[model samples]
Target: RFGDKFIRVSFSIPTPEVERFVDAFPKVMAEL
Candidate 1:
């Protein structure tokens, strides 16, 4: 039960690195 809860929280967490990567992707592609 505890492990399942941890997994849920992990998936729920928003990661800034991912957000930054996503935000930069379009500019990088546009330059190509």
Candidate 2:
């Protein structure tokens, strides 16, 4: 797990990027 790194970075990034990442997050987890 990413611990607080993901949580902290998500808030700093653009909303669009975060949304895009959100969609891809599950896909990444599945691959892992």
Candidate 3:
């Protein structure tokens, strides 16, 4: 039988990493 067999889950970054990403986002977008 066809089945998922296992469950999947999503993960997120911590607050500090997110903040650093946000701060550098503009520079990242600019390069692209």
Candidate 4:
């Protein structure tokens, strides 16, 4: 349903929220 290597990310939240996502993203990917 998606194109190659497409990962959706949004920056529409507060700075703290975005920072949290950036911090947690790599760990999430490691489990995937």
Candidate 5:
């Protein structure tokens, strides 16, 4: 899904909405 460099950059500080979206993403993905 992500390259090494992308993975490294992905962990930078996330906004509150981003954090909430990330929290729900796994559940959404699992349902699909």
Candidate 6:
């Protein structure tokens, strides 16, 4: 899923952004 790409990028992003991304990750994975 596209979530994989986001996961890969999430680590390279800033902490705040990664936190937000992590927060949303569960919902995204659930949707998949």
Clash statistics: count for each candidate = 0, 0, 0, 0, 0, 0
Model 4 lDDT per residue over 1-32, tens place: 33232233344567797788779988998999
Which candidate tops lDDT? 2
Question: Which candidate wins on TM-score?
Answer: 2
- Compared with the true structure, what per-residue lDDT tens digits does model 2 show for residues 1-32? 67699999999999999999999999999999
Q: Which window of 10 residues has the lowest lDDT sum in candidate 2? A: 1-10
Residue 18 error, candidate 4, Å? 0.4
Clashing pairs in 4: none
lDDT (10s digit) by residue, model 1, range 1-32: 96697567656768785566568868988999
Query: How does each model score on TM-score?
Result: 0.53, 0.83, 0.57, 0.63, 0.56, 0.63
lDDT of 5 by residue, 1-32 (tens): 45575455556646775677678978988999
Number of the candidate with higher lDDT, 1 or 4: 1
CA lDDT of every candidate: 0.72, 0.95, 0.57, 0.66, 0.68, 0.86
Better of 1 and 4 by TM-score: 4
Comparing 2 with 3 on lDDT, the higher-scoring candidate is: 2
Displacement of residue 6 (Cα, Å) in model 6 is 6.9
The sequence of per-residue lDDT tens digits that candidate 6 reaches over residues 1-32 is 87698778977899998898789978988999
Q: Can you write out model 3's per-residue Cα lDDT over 1-32, one digit (the tens) per residue? A: 21232111112666687677768878988999
**lDDT of candidate 3?**
0.57
Candidate 4's C-alpha lDDT? 0.66
- Quote model 6's TM-score: 0.63
Query: Model 2 segments beyond 4 Å from truth?
Result: none
